[model samples]
Target: MPESNNCCEAQGLDAITAKSHMDESIKPTEPSLIQQVIDNPTGDGITDTNLRVPEGCPRIDPCPAKAAIQTQECETEKGDGDNIALERARNAPPGPLGPVPTGHGENVPLEYWTPLGDLTGTRPAVENFSLSRFSPNEWNEHNKKLSAACHDGIQVATTAGFNALCSISRAYAEADRNQMDNNIRLSTRAGTIHRWTVELERMIADIIEEIDLVQEVRRRTMRVKSVLQVVENIDKDMMRIRCFRMDNDLVRDQVSEEVTKELSLCEEIRDVYIRLLDQIKMQIEELITAKRRVEFDWSEKKEAYEIETESRGLGSQSDTILWKAGSTRIPPDQSSPSGYEYSTKQVLAEGYTAKQRSSTLRVNVDAMIEKAVKDLRDQADRVDLTLTQQIQLQEQALRRLEAELYKDLQQLSDTETLIDEMHDASKKLDGAMKCAQTRLDKRLLRHGVENCRDVPQFGLIEEVKSLSESVSATLGQLKRAENSTSSLIQSRRDIEKEMVVKRPVILTVPYYVCDRRSYKSNAQLEIQSP
Candidate 1:
């Protein structure tokens, strides 16, 4: 009972000490280094002096350590108490000199008296007797208990220490791993930002170069238009000169024809130039639009570079790092990586295509203007030369027509003969068809099963179909032949009328010559008089 009471008293003292420790630990004081680290994990404002533990501060170890220490101290106190008790028993006086009386009738001093036996015949049961007094001293038993408790406490302390160590080590390892991953993420992001910045720079330069080239093309296009305008003015002057002649002299002559042709050529060339200008203008506008997009993207790239660079600068020791709300989440309208790259490529491609087209147009502009001028100056001579050639060809064609007329007349007679032949063949085919049909009709006269299609019946049916088709084809050929005969006769009549109309008269050419000479003289007189 005393041992149990001592154990309970020790536990009560331990609890009181623990409660007092808790209160002491919770007492407000100057901010500790750990609290500082939590508030500013980067340790930006911390110093080596702050790392030293303060005097009188409670130990920073976990709860189990303190509990184990308290248990060991309690066991030591218990052992000390047992030792004191043994010393007291060793120094005490001896027991009584002789055996005391059993009080069943034995003589004994009253000071060592015994109680009377039960008068109702109630005696102690023999089975209830115990030899615990003769077994071992209470002190020895208590010592054994204290020794076992000390051993158990040692095992518990060792296990708790192992668990605490493992937990702390794992925590430190995880923290380091997280830091490494963060560094890698930031580094990779920075590289991406730098690469995009370089690409944007290149795109911007390309767009600017393209813009310059397109402007040059525009200048060339304007110059070509100006040259075309000058050519138009020259054509106008020519037309004006032709108009100055009197109305009678202004008759449609070679000079007037040549001037009109040149004016028309000049107008056509001007129209081409005007359309080219419009195309160049449109190309320039397209290039400008592409340039704007590139510039905008370039600016965005610069901003992204700045942001990434700033992010890379942030370190564990950086004071500026703070929790930014929604920073980890993707924002609305943000483009994906592929979308960004595609848009950039589209912008560059548009610029390149526009610049290439502009260059091609600029190159062709000179060639087109040169060809137009050459055609304009030589067009009238070529026309007069072609007119002469056309007259010769017409004469040749007239002669060839006379020859064709003779051939056509012969062909018409042949066609009439063919038509008669076709009619005769058609009649022959009709007779053949009737003969085959008569055979088929005779075969049908067989009764019942004998009327079935035999070899001869099939042969007769085929013959009848062949003959019918032949007759149909012959009739169609005869009709076409008659049509050809009619067309040939009409062609002959037309040829005869054309030959008569084309027949030259001796006075007609001479009169035409006389009229041309008179007309020329009149025009010359009017010009000379003016």
Candidate 2:
């Protein structure tokens, strides 16, 4: 205490016992971000016991006339306690209602008043000074020479201190949370854009091979070559699956797996159909050749039998049957030479019997030829039906492919649009950042620091730094979108770095409301460190 030269005067302690801590003379000021971060919640510098606070704390009466005055030796033992400064600050003018009417202009608050206790040194015109008229009375009635109004010794009322601290702390904490959330949101958006761009570009690259396959299939499909009257029904399919990505990883995996499986099935079906068509063509050709052979031989034999019967005075026996249209086979029969015919029919009676037997043979063979032709027609019909079904299946597959391709195309279109939007935002942010940088450079130059490192940073410098960081992050994201597949985790780290600026944001709003005031050049106006 060292005699506590800065102790509250007896005349100035009355308001601490009567009014609010936020006195009119002491307007609320912004909470200092630095202070809040450092101010421990453990306790204020005071006794822990509640009982020792408002009432039981030692009374600091500086008045020499007070009956309970402590000895000088007792004051020398307490050391230089800050309570001396606190008490003086709490009770000094301007009074709680505002500036007291001094013979001079208004007196400034003690905290900002220079030279530690004398205000007349700064403003020589002020006359009714509080320092000159010290008194033991609340109204200075002990002398009745100074003003009756006075400030309080309590910076905060004991009963209301807890609530005020809690409210202010909450406001700062809320601001911190909001700023952190904004940083997180920006990171998430950046990551999403990056992931989509990478995925889309990869898909577009992969699609080249699929397009080639489709073209190859198209070249071979439905083509009949080399005079083989063979019709081909090849299944041609191209699968393209494009989808807009979301944050749902599990869903994306499932969709990707499913699309791959279905496309594979389409290729397998195409292969099976191609093999089936080849087999069917070979089988049909064999059947058709057999039928053609049987028809030709039967026709030759039937004509000979009818001629022999007519010459023997017997009625004509026309047992010949022709092959049906669209026959898939040819007969293998050949005409018999004259030498063989005569050798087969020796002696007149034997020849007549042989003729009858020949007629029977001709009829039997003709019926066989008709049966072969019927079989060929039936097989061809069945193969045609099967081929048609296969063709229908192929067409259906093509349609499904087109649908998927359409979706892929739509996804590509959407991704391109998103990329464009990102570029536009990047350009806008770049321009704004450049402007902020110019302003910062000018400020630094004015402060005689060409480099930002040499200057002491304030709100403007911090704002510029913050904008630069945000711009850099966006540019990084755009770069990744255009050409890189860098992990988005880096973006998250960038966001965390950005969050460092969030702390000061907590006190910014309150400062504007509580500390903001118009410029005043009055000698008594306090010069705050804004």
Q: Local error of candidate 1 at 494, Å?
A: 50
The numbered model that scores best in lDDT is 1
Worst 10 residues of 2 by lDDT: 226-235
Residue-wise lDDT of candidate 1 within 404-497, one digit each (tens)?
9989999998999999888888887877888899999988899999899999998998898888888888888888999999999999998876
TM-score of 1: 0.39
Best by TM-score: 1
Query: In model 1, which runs have C-alpha deviations exceeding 4 angstroms?
Result: 1-185, 246-251, 353-530
The alpha-carbon RMSD values of the candidates against the true structure, listed in the order shown, are: 38.1, 73.2
